[model samples]
Target: MGSGFSVLLPVYDGDSPEFLERSFDSVTVDQTRPPSEVVIVQDGPVRPELTRMLARLVDRSDVPVVLVEIPVNGGLARALDLGLERCSHEIVARQDADDISVPERFAVQVPIVEGGADVVGSAIEEFVVEGDGGLVRVPPVGHEEIERYARFRSPFNHPSVVYRRSAVRAVGGYEELPLMEDYWLFARMIHAGAWAENVVEPLVLYRVGAGAYARRGGTRLLQSEVELQRRMWRAGMTSFWSFSRNVAVRGVYRVTPEPVRRRAYRAAVRRDAEREAHTDQHTDQPGTTDAGQD
Candidate 1:
């Protein structure tokens, strides 16, 4: 197994320079096991502030930072596909420009990848501010549980994922799917028989605010949801009834009011107390499957 991994981060014009710096710091200076290199894709012409910030980050980084410039504004899928091509290592961990990874995130995930998992992800904590406590979104752990959960929802936290480049490329990297690109790629990987797992611990701090909730709803997202469901059905990842159910349920969720959507989203994640209770119930039990926690 290779000892080094690359960090793939794509930044666009709208991203805040401050957030980007923090993100870069988290994966580089702050990490216990820093990446061998960081491939930053400038999805388009960013603002002057972001441009300067990128220059400073590269200058300050101890590890190599590869900057790939896209002349025009392409979507996240395109940016990521292009970035993946530039990554120098077989193991590539994803990082979002606006999110912060825990210092030990890579330390905990890289070993699992070396141990034979094609893809590994972890729970994420969503926060409106930098220091405030946040709600944790925990996905199912273990390969079988991940495969079963993929039929209903995204099995991995895209920003928190560490995957093998060959596995992702063999399944044909990200395709254009608006808001559902990550889910689409993951679904394809899962269907292609990738070995996947998720850690119960939250490994990244996901930024969530009014904009995040607002983006979740809207006509465009509803349309994306419909198309995603159709693709999943055609791909044999979901049964006919499952596809229909997803369209009806997720489609409505997309078009609902932002406040209602926010409540629904929060309801799906666990609070600190709930997480502790769940850990107590599921951890260190004899002959018990990790699926019981989900």
Candidate 2:
């Protein structure tokens, strides 16, 4: 398989310039299998500091860096769709503007995509502070398991995925789905019969804190949850019963109090991490002990 790949990263005004620098360095300077090019999509007008940082990143980057600018602030889904068009390689790896990818992330995922998987993602380690203790969020490993898991929750970590550009474009790229854009696109890809898998190892350091949990709740997200469920049912990706169950369960989570939601989210992540650690002991899989949630 060709080692050439493009890293698609989207940044907005809300993103910290410091975090963006770390994220960019992780995918470019720190990767064991660095991307051939990096595409940074300016979702909207950013702070002056961010603009300067972007200029600096481009000036010092060893690989090609393509900057796609949007005059107005568009949401993540729209920004990603535009950025995907500028990607110059068949293979594309996603990187969040605030996350840190492990150096070997692409080294392991790229080969799986070349082996015929249309989409490949890995688990992530969610941390509030870099190098601090974090939980690893593990996803199901096999394609069949991933398909089954998608019926209830997201089957892949958005920022940790490496996929063929053709597969994503064939599925209609990313539609404007509020906060659930990644899940929506993945569901459509699955319905379109795209092969998918998730590496159990934690490959990215996902930053999570009070703000992250707070954003997960609220009326806007609840509305998006309902809309996403409706779209999934209309597309025949979920049965009527599944749709009803999801609307009831996920909807409640979206509207719950932020503190309650945060506790529940962390608890679930801890359980998954413990379960993965136990499984690793019995199997020969090479991975870390703690797991994270996404």
Clashes of each: 0, 6
* Tens digits of per-residue lDDT for model 1, 1-294: 348999999999999999999999999999989999999999989889999999999998998999999999999999999999999999999999999999999999999999999999998988889889688888877787778778888888899999999999998899999988999999999899999988888999999866888998899989988999999999999999999999999988998898899998888765533754565576668876555345
116-232, model 2: which lDDT tens digit per residue? 999999999899989994878887767776887888889898999999999999989999989999999999998899999889889999998668888989999899999999999
For candidate 1, the 10 contiguous residues with the lowest summed lDDT are: 270-279
Q: Return the TM-score for candidate 1, rounded to 2 decimals.
A: 0.95
TM-score of each: 0.95, 0.93
CA lDDT scores, all candidates in order: 0.90, 0.90
In order, what is each prediction's RMSD in angstroms? 2.1, 3.9
Assess candidate 2 and give its lDDT. 0.90
